[model samples]
Target: MVSTGITPSGIFHIGHIREILTGDMLTRAALDAGMEVEMIFIIDTADPLRKVYDFLAPEFENYIGHPIGAIPAPDGAGKPSEGGNYGEHFLSPFVEA
Candidate 1:
């Protein structure tokens, strides 16, 4: 089994691509070599928010040290939105892509 993990503290970025793709490539290579491989992607939603980023609202100060998956996602104005939690909000697009 091949495992890849990412902390969902902020938005997905290019750096994340490298790690996830590396795991995927390894899995593909092993499969091509006649090995049975299972790839698992782990999202560290239980990780705490370290700070309020420039892209996040000042209101997020209330969430510091709290688990990201338990807090609300930021809206366009950087305020908390009703859509979903921070982890899912940032991860959805990357996973969909």
Candidate 2:
């Protein structure tokens, strides 16, 4: 098994992609080498909202240390998601990618 983890605390940067891609490439290479491989990805939706992001309103400061999945979306993307959680909001795009 090949495992990679991401904590959606802020922007989805190139470093995040690099880790995922590395794991994926390793998994694929193992498969090609006649080995069975399972790709595992860990999304840390429960990570805390540590600080108020530049894009977020100052009110978000009140949510510091709260689980990201329990907080509202900073951008008010929509219902459920708007109030869904921080990590998942950012995580969706990474999953699609």
Candidate 3:
């Protein structure tokens, strides 16, 4: 089995893509060589909000110690009940791409 994950902290930067791509190439090569391989992509939605990111609003300061997934969507794309799944906000776009 092969596993690779990103925290979805904010942007899906090139460095993040590099890691995933590396994992994907390895998995594909293994499969092509007749080796059974399982690839797992991780999204750490529950990671805690640390310092405020430059792109974030001042309101996010209140959520420093909370789990990002438990906070409201910064862009108003979250549900009232779920507030927002922080990782989901960034992960969704990456997956779709």
Candidate number with greatest lDDT = 1
Report the lDDT tens digits of candidate 2 across residue range 1-97: 9989888977799989888899999999999999999999888778788877777777787888998878877665322334556777788787787
Query: What is the TM-score of candidate 3?
Result: 0.75
Name the candidate, 1 or 3, with the larger TM-score value. Answer: 1
Candidate 3 ranges beyond 4 A from true positions: 76-83
Candidate 3 positional error at 89, Å = 2.2
Reference-based TM-score of each model = 0.83, 0.75, 0.75
* lDDT for position 96 in model 3: 92
The pairs that clash in candidate 1 are none
- Cα deviation at 60, candidate 2, in Å, is 1.5
**Residue 48 in candidate 1, Cα distance off native in Å:** 1.2
Flag the better candidate by TM-score, 2 or 3: 3
Q: lDDT rank, highest first?
A: 1, 2, 3
**Cα lDDT for residue 21, candidate 3:** 94
lDDT per residue for candidate 3 within 34-92, as digits (tens), equals 99999998777778988678777776788787887787666743222344566677677
In order, the Cα lDDT scores of the candidates are 0.91, 0.80, 0.77
Of 1 and 2, the candidate ranking higher by lDDT: 1
Q: How many residue pairs clash in each candidate?
A: 0, 0, 0
Which prediction has the highest TM-score against the true structure? 1
